[model samples]
Structure formats: C-alpha cells, structure tokens
Target: MRDMKRIGNDRVTSIGLGTWGIGGKEFPDYSHDREAIEALRYGIELGINLIDTAEFYGAGHSEELVGEAIKPFDRDELFIVSKIWPTHFGYDSAIKAAKASAKRLGTYIDLYLLHWPGDSFEKIKQTLHALEDLVDEGIIRYIGVSNFDLELLRRSQEVMRRYEIVVNQVKYSLMDRTPEETGLLEYMKKEGMTLMAYTPLEKGILARNKCLEEIGKKYGKTAAQVALNYLIWEDNVVAIPKAIRKEHVKENAGAMGWRLSKEDRERARLCV
Candidate 1:
C-alpha cells in the first residue's frame, strides 16, 4: 500500500499477489485451494489491490480462485490483470480467451496482456487488434504484453495505434537481470510503460540471500523484504511476488513503506 504505481488510470500497490501457483495441480506446491484463497484474501485485507493471474494458469483455475477470493471486496477498488495464451494469439481466439478469463474472474479485467509474442507478425497484429476491440467493448480497460523483447514491444506498439501498451510483465529478479541488461527496463521507462516484474524473488532464492539479509538488518526487515523492496523502489516498476501462505503474505507486505539507500540499491545490484 505504501508504494503505489499507476497503470493507465488505475493506481495499484507496487506489491501485488501473483496467482501462478494458486491455479491448482498444475503447480504441485500450490495444491491447497483453501490456503491459496485465504492468503489472497489476507493480502487484500492488508491493502494489496493488484492481483495478477492468467487463463493459462491451471487452465483458468487461477482466475476462478481470484474470483472467489475477491467476492467480498468492492470490484472497483482492485486492479485485476490477466493474460491470453500465445497459442490464442489471433483476432478471434484472443477475443474468446479474454471473455473466458473475464467470466472466470467474475469481473471485467483491468488490464489484459498477450502472454508472449506470436510466431508471426500477422498473428501478433491480429491479436492486438482484438485487444483494442475488447477495450472498445469495455471487456478490458487496457492492453499489454508479456515476455516481449525490445523489438517485439516496439512492433506491438506500432500495430496498436488506438491504445498504448501500458505494461510489460516479465521475469525479473536479483538473479535474473536480463531485462535491465538488455536495456528493456530503460526502453520501458522511456515509453511510459510499467515494468511488471514477475518472479521478483527468483522462486525464493533471493529471499535467502546473505547480502539482502545484511541490508535488511539496517531496515529491520527480512532478506525477502529487502529483495522485494529493491524491485518496487523505482517509480516505473512493480513487483508481483506469489505467496500462498498467510505468514508469507504478511512478510511480502512488509516490503513496502520503506526506502533503500542509493548505495544499498547499487550494492544489491552488484551482489546479485
């Protein structure tokens, strides 16, 4: 709740709940439906309004869990993001996927993204056109893409002249710095797009880093919190770390409301 990043007209917490595992048996570690629901609800109760899910996740089970977990909250208060699978990249299939995801989420999607680049430019063009149409029809508020490199992102923007691509979700963590190394982070900032960092914890590796732990001691936070804070400390970036346990959710929330010094941020970058 402390670091709020704006996506289009919506302002959401820099720290969001990711539902990749909550999708069900597809992820062996997240088979507990009840715990997943409880953790999501607990996150929202703590003012975490950004929830990221996808139709491909558990073949739509993740959206269903998100739908159930968000039932008690005002729909307008949350920013729900979902994605269309790469195989569904086309005018018709993309539209169908968006509608199906919305139905499962039990609300209009705040932002819908193309999960990845298609095999052909024509295919990508068709999918972007469909997303533009969905925005026109009010099925989705904004359009975006994920796992795109610099050229694909540029091409996607050129193809969709009607609406701006507001976000680019990718795997970025202390361990995986490819986005920054390849200048994708700089390009995104230049184009006014939010870099939605998925797997910001590197699947728990950075959570146990000795460098992050040392940095966290100064802030009275955990290494995981320090690692997460490093991601959201910037203005044009947001980190969505998945947590299916109440205790983990609380720890994730603790990453907010504090700032890391410039030296420490640089140290983290070098250490990782």
Candidate 2:
C-alpha cells in the first residue's frame, strides 16, 4: 500500500489520483478514454486508494470513467471524492447535485466537497448544510470544501451543525505555497483537517523543476516524487496530481513509502 493519511477518521492514500483532465477538462473528451481507464486501473494496481473527481471536471464524464474503471475493485477499499459545482450552491440544488454525482460514480461518494466558494455566504452555508444532509442520507460519508481561503474556511466550519469539515482541497505545490504562506495550512493542521494538495506538480511543470530534480538525485527519486513527498511530509496533507498517462500514474504512485530529510524538505522552498 502507498503511504496513508487521516481525514477525520477516514484514511486515504497520501498520493491520491486527481481526474481533472482524464475524460476532459471542461467538456467531454473521449479521445483517450481507454488510456484514461487503463491509467486509473494501473494506479489502483499500484495501491492508490483515494481518487478525487468532481462534477465540473470533464462535465461529469470523469466520474463516469472512474465508475467504469473501479468496477472490479472492492468499493469499501477505495476512497472516492467528488465535488458539487457552484451552479448547485443552493440547499436543494446541492443535494440534487450530490445525488447526480453519486449516480455518475455508480457508488456513494466517500467524500463530497463544495467545488468552490459560493457567490454568497448564505449560499455557502446552505451548501454546507446540504452536504451534512447527504451524510445523514448516507449518500456521502464525509464533508469538505475546495478553494476556500482561511477566513471563509472558518465561517464554513461554523455553518456545519452536525459533522466537521474534514478537508480543504486547494492548489498547493512546491511552486505554489499560498496555503502555507497564508497560515491556512497551519490552522488546518491545528484543527485536524486535511489539506488536500491539488496541482501538486504545477500542471506537470514541477516534474521538470530544476531544484526538485537536483534534490531528488540524492534520493534516487524523480522531481515529481520529491515534490509530492514534500507535501505529504506534513502528515495531514495529501498531494493529488492528475495524470492519465500510465507512466505518470506509476511515477506518482512511487512518491510515497519513503521520507525526505528535514533539511532537504526545507531546501524545496527555494524551488526554481
């Protein structure tokens, strides 16, 4: 198994799969459907249990492909995450969206997040409450929010009446440390929330990062692996870099199962 991290009581692989471009980005692209499904299965073969997808990704085609890919695996063993887009930010719309996403996934979503901050705080509160209701209905297991800043994250948490927000998926990478720089990372750690690092490779640019490559050489690892290791080093963080290519999926799977020295971890701050 790959290294694991905790989100409340649920455990997920530190190196989870992000399926943003697998089926398509904003629309459906079936050109690489076979390769995409194969890559997802390969990641599972390599012990990746956490898979992140959203209704906005590939216009919900990503969830369909994920549903098809994990058909043979035990559902209980896989941690599936999906998000509700802003279009469905209202109470009823949020519930409908979660049900729709779960239908596409062909299984109950293990974790459901608000894709982005709603346009109104009232709308966000309604969405958060809807997510909690999903948990009550057993359509979703955990609740989370994505792209929420520190201040908004606090208020969102306050909106929750039954369950706790267990994760905040954000764009975090060696090249982008806004979460860390803004103290959001620290506060989440203190609150025992997981900071799911999306774009951990900076859209594959970090795979070729000179600083990470140089540092990885000493550990017999790739720049991408080194970069992902840096994010998971926090224990409460998991890096989700999207890759539909089999080689890249395998490479990402190798990111964990080892440790980076504290000195080397700090040196990554000077990424270039």
lDDT computed for candidate 2? 0.91
Please list all clashing residue pairs in model 1, or write none if there are none: none
* lDDT per residue (tens digit) for residues 19-42 in model 2: 987788633548888888898999
Estimated TM-score per prediction? 0.97, 0.97
Report how far residue 102 has shifted in candidate 1, in Å. 0.6
- Would you list the clashing residue pairs of candidate 2? none
**Which parts of model 2 have CA positions greater than 4 angstroms off?**
26-28
For TM-score, the strongest prediction is 2
Global lDDT scores for all candidate models: 0.90, 0.91
